[model samples]
Target: MDQRTNRTFICSVLFIDIVECSTKPVEEQIWLKERFNALLSETIKDIAVNDRILLDTGDGAALGFLGDPEDALFVAMELRDSAMNDQRDPSLSLSIRMGINLGPVKLVKDINQQLNLIGDGINVAQRIMSFADPGKLLVSRSYYEVISCLSQEYAKLFSDEGLHADKHVRQHRIYAVGHYEFKKATIGVPVSRKTAPEPKEAPLTDQPQQGENRSIDTQASRYRKTITLLLATLPQRPFHKKWISAAIPLAILVVLFAAFALRGGKGTTENPSSPKVVTAVPRPKPSVTRVAPPDTKKTEPLRSTDPSISQPLSSKRVARIGFTLSAVERKGLDITLTVSLKNTAADARSVALYDNHYSWPKSHLTDKGGRSYEVQEVYFRKGGKRISMYDTGKTGIPINGGATVTAHLVFRKFPDSSREAVLNLHPFIYYGWRWTEHDVNFPDISLE
Candidate 1:
């Protein structure tokens, strides 16, 4: 074990890391770095090996060892135990991943005069890292076999999930020793850092997989399940629409279908049984039918189509007005919306708002097309007088997620110049709560 060049024994390079390092925020870097450094120093000091700790790779540590595979397995297990039993701050606790490979290595001095180690040992160790779980350890067969010869301590290691030679050239056989049962966890986040060597692309084999595709499949499955559960408990109701606007579409379809059936696919050919012809049939009788000349109806311009420039250009842009409701007193309707402008743009463009207040859509709320809600009317006060020029149009605002944005709607009469009018709107709004809800926060709405 002396510092000599005569050593030619098979040595294993082991890599260890904490899983799910991405969840740790940049704000906690100081705390994480301290805990990780301390833990590594302590663990390495306790392990019986002539190994040298090469570097601190953020979430995990990299180390080079000059021992047989058996000793490497022992060191890896101890590292996992230390992490769990660590007496440090609970918030700073972490896990580790250990990789092992048997290869020749040589230690030398670097430009900074620090002891350095290199060879196939470190490479294989990183591969083992991909195979291990939070509290488990994985080792290569070369490692398992050689270490088992030295001692039967790690003979129970077995193959785990995928022969995990992931997309990064990091490949290996996995193992889960001890009473630890691997719990299925969604990879809700990703990890960062590992500057020693850039990750190389994994070599292709017989079976290849796209991890991202699996993730998408997982999300779709969750969405389907959520919909199923919601429908199971939700009340069933027929979908309706806004009056004549709704009936017109149905009427058009009915007419088209009727015409198709009557013509029998003859392409506008007349049918003797059609009402148009049947009613006029014994026509010898004085003609009682009256038909309008085609020119009698006035043509109209479509909201979108530009058949010709002869049609006058429209100057109407849909405009909306909304307001923010900060802290509303349910009793007095006294709210605090002192203009929460996060950051204004250089052009001073459309002012961004925190959120809008809306009365939750109810009876007056039209349940058109199976919507969970309807446009809720909202009101704001000016000079102690209630004004009702608001829109229930835009449903929810990007207020942290659940915030409501009542749009500017048709203005109607207010109760009186003395009394405040009640505007129908959804009350609950979410802000600054991204963890509880995604950033579905609606932008602040206004009547300005």
Candidate 2:
């Protein structure tokens, strides 16, 4: 038996696919294949040939790296940069999407008795490749975690795209790797600099010198001293004396007015005992009208307690189903969501919910400002244990007729000001060798 056969080992798998390869002409396609193969060879020249296996996949290829996982990411980035710089034929310019995953894969012999690799790692890497846009790269959570520990510079290149839901794999976190050339291009525009004003030189003129200006200063000083002497000679009363002299006469007038008032009131008091006919004036009482108190019986707004009521209405019946966002909780940079899915069909044994092979379900939160928060992680909340989508040993949950399952999905946190967000669930269903994506829009839910 070969030493590389029937043995499982940890490695990184990189899957790449050319964008719109079928649309190109036969000659152009041949040129692109040659160009891309040469580019890949040049990119991985530093890596040992035995440590990496390049398998052609019709339009693109799958690279298996048994060495350090970071080497795979570095190669993918190099391939992207090299392809971008390839200006031989603009029409044959190759734009590819790449995905990387790190996991245990087994090396086995194919039907032709040739050594080949197959495992969940390769499948996941292919799925992640589907998530990336043309000229972009994406990596599975496992690959990201491995490279994160190996290289900080490599880890910083990835942005958290959040949890992605695939048909085979329910939900897994994926990260988008930043392209070096794109970053440089985005920051290439230089900032405008302000020009400083030119200093104006003094005009040469027959103006008075320092000695001439000193005479003017002396004359101004003499004039100011003369004005000060005049001000000193003028008669001015002290501030306290002026206030007291004005107050004495005002006080005397107030005392005389008070004496006259007292004298005038004495006559009315002395005549009061002679014949004061005391008349009692009756006070009018305020009228009191007794009114009925308002009805305090609190009427609760009619709300359905059934869990299905909160489920968003399905726009199109791709698989005869219903989905509802039960709860959404956000803490710092993490968001937790509980979604209820019910199978509405009675005759269908198993309904295909959604297909995430080519693309993930666009399950994301959109704020009023048009910012989107993509789903980051997904799991089945079964009792106390959380079943991850990447659990290869377990198959997808089967939903028979009238059966329902609660899916717990976690998304990247929205901005702080995003109090209310519209949750959009776009699921692509695979049918008849083609994919049909259904757009299910849920009403805006509160994030508070």
Candidate 3:
């Protein structure tokens, strides 16, 4: 291969790191890597051979996509979902954290002269993967921007995860692609049992195993005995062959006539019956009684003193959501958003404000100009002190039914020209087979 011609190109890089592979037994680790490679190949088989590259990273691997950036994004999610549905041994459970980034990279020959990817592209991708929760996918800002423009459906899968400070790179904006099933699988939640139930043994009497031949012989003997008895009961005298043949036709004709007689005939008309005199009965009309109308002057209008008591209940009595953009403050590139959410859901539920878990809920802000910003920092005020959502080890703000909670969401500042924005709450829900977008739009509010 010509080193110069094959060396470099701009492409999307997908770096996947197996979570805790070193902690597992060496045998188990080997099994996990084999399974991971098999799944990765099966999932991205549609991509052309020359357009993609897979380099084993010991615990995980790095995949390069020379085609559309969307393909890399798709393959990442597909691998996660497929791994979740994998029926491998539970002991060999494989969970991966994947990161996708698009940039220019150089391909070089290693000591073994094998093609290896080296550049800021793959390096940054590996760092991004480290930040991801196991079985989750994270993407760089560039990858997000490109894919979002290519397909809206694919765009909805990603939620902004604010600026992440890396050791090698300064603050980098990252977006997370939602994969709930993969998250559950990583936590060892068996969505479907891999091992099938054991087969039950059949009863000796019902099962036709050793005694099958004997049973058949017994049935044959009984049939033979029945035939012998019927033959004995039959007349012993021999009848003429001609008479027998003629009687068979006559019997068939008589039976056909009898069947027709009993069936009330196909085209035959019925005999006329005597006409009887008719009589008519009439129904009595309902009586209409006139009554005076009630006195309107003595009645008072019904009313309630509390406005909340008079407020009509929502038709959907399940989860009633109310959102408001309380305040917005900007300091340089950082913006703080105060949002108040009311949940009248039947149970005490947490609105996914932010979380460190791969499976946690997420919220984003979309400006009127169609630009979206992911929440960078999340905290709430309680007892006159700010409580960080991440430090509290809670995925979202907890609100009881018929109660409201407020949280402060921070994000990279919107463009200085942005005057209005919409807060997207619970933007995505993964249903295993497919995903659902349940973005609750908060009314547009002024940034001022």
Model 2: how far is 300 from its true place, Å?
Answer: 21
lDDT of 3 by residue, 364-384 (tens): 777756777777677776546
lDDT of 3 at 425: 54
lDDT of 1 at 105: 65
> On a 0 to 1 TM-score scale, where does candidate 1 land against the true structure?
0.36
Q: Least lDDT summed over 10 consecutive residues: which range in candidate 1? A: 432-441
lDDT (CA) for every model shown? 0.40, 0.60, 0.59
Each prediction's TM-score against the native?
0.36, 0.45, 0.42
In the range 1-448, model 2's lDDT, one tens digit per residue, is 3666787767889999888787889887887788888888888887787777778898899988875556687688778877877898775678888999987778888888866889987888888888777898999887777555432334456677765556555666778877765433443311111111222222112233233322212222332343334345546744221132244344435444644665574664544223222111122232232323322355332222343334342222445666666666667766666666666777422222222222445466677677777766666644455656544123444456676666665676468776656666654433222233455665545666
TM-score, model 2 to reference:
0.45
Q: Alpha carbon lDDT of residue 405, candidate 2?
A: 64
Q: 277-341 in candidate 1: lDDT tens per residue?
A: 10101112211223222232343311212222222222111011223323211113222111121
Distance from true location, Cα of 390 in model 2, Å: 27
